[model samples]
Target: MAFVQLLVTSLLILVTKADVAIDIENASSDVYWIGILANPGLPIPSNGGFVLNGGQTTTVSVPDNWVGRFWARTGCDSGTNTCQTGDCRNGVECAGNGGAPPVTLVEITIKGDGGQDFYDISLVDGFNVKASIQPIDGTGDCSTAECESDVNAACPEQLKDGDYACYSSCAKFNTDQYCCRNELNFHSLMIIISPRVPLKFQMITVV
Candidate 1:
């Protein structure tokens, strides 16, 4: 499989108090279809999607209180507008649609409660590209959140999705323990498995 990496920067400017700037960069030699799914009633940036070629970068502006998830679609066929992984089944522009799993997700809630920003790189849906977020300029305990390891290289046989992605245990087995579907303490389980923390960022990268 070809190695793919994306670098994104979320630039929070002191002057632009009402908006945030997201700089998405494709650092690898591959074409990536960007997908953005914003909260209902909120405007979607770039009409919810765009394309980034290798070494190319694009900036998207959103409200300071924007809440959404961003992901990249790989191995996309322009003719059919579908991807081998992370396909939303709606072409390049997701338009509020989310990508299919085995996808690495960058979830964020800007200017959230108590005037804090929360962001995380999630693998609960599985893993396609190695991704990370780095906080540039922000208040409070700003730290990098990442899933930088090559999960696909070390994925167990049962969780392997060909050579492109790795399926999470829950996605592969659909069991209560893995999915926390029927668990009474689902929230607790989630915290143990995937913890969310406050983070401010200007850059995101996928490898």
Candidate 2:
């Protein structure tokens, strides 16, 4: 997946050292199974996954230094515990496993250098849904990272995964250039969004 390197600076204000509060909501009409993947040795919230019905919201707490990613799995079967998109292949709880490609991701790192938190929305895997992240009651430059557009509507015919999700060129073709494998700088991988569509949000690196 594409990675965005965020730069965070020290703040003069006294930052309270506590677990970070993450509020997740399902803004769409479809039922969503929220998946969590934490860094190795870190705790995975909600045992790695949970279900969120339409318009439902839930909160999860993570340590100040937690590092992880979150995504939503759609078209899941309750009996089989599988999903048409973003399935981890191990049932509802990913148990630290990441979602399948062609899924939207919200990546985060809490309390890094100088007590700054870093976050971004990545489509390097591809776009399955419109997703966003907003900081609530935080200090310093806490900007929202989001992609509000319906990318699936403009997804190229070749990149479409049925009618449910869109695949990144790299995921579909596995070419070095599309995957940024040729680049020596590992931090700035280039993701190619279809030029035929107008993206509503630029991939953001926020502190």
Model 1, position 182, has a per-residue lDDT of 56
Clashing residue pairs in candidate 1 are 5-206, 6-206, 8-203, 8-204, 9-202, 9-203, 10-202, 10-203
Per-residue lDDT of model 1, residues 10-94, tens digit only: 2111112346767777777788888888888888988778888887777778787778888888889999989988898889888
lDDT per residue as tens, model 2, 95-206: 8778898888877877666767777778877888776665655667777666767788888899999999998777789876566555632534544455766573332332
Would you list the C-alpha lDDT of every candidate in the order shown?
A: 0.69, 0.70
Candidate 1's C-alpha lDDT?
A: 0.69
- Model 2 alpha-carbon miss at residue 90, Å: 1.3
In model 2, where is the ten-residue run with the lowest total lDDT?
Answer: 6-15
Q: What CA root-mean-square deviation does each model show from the true structure?
A: 7.7, 7.1
> Which stretches of candidate 1 lie above 4 Å from their native place?
1-17, 184-207
TM-score of model 2 relative to the true fold? 0.81
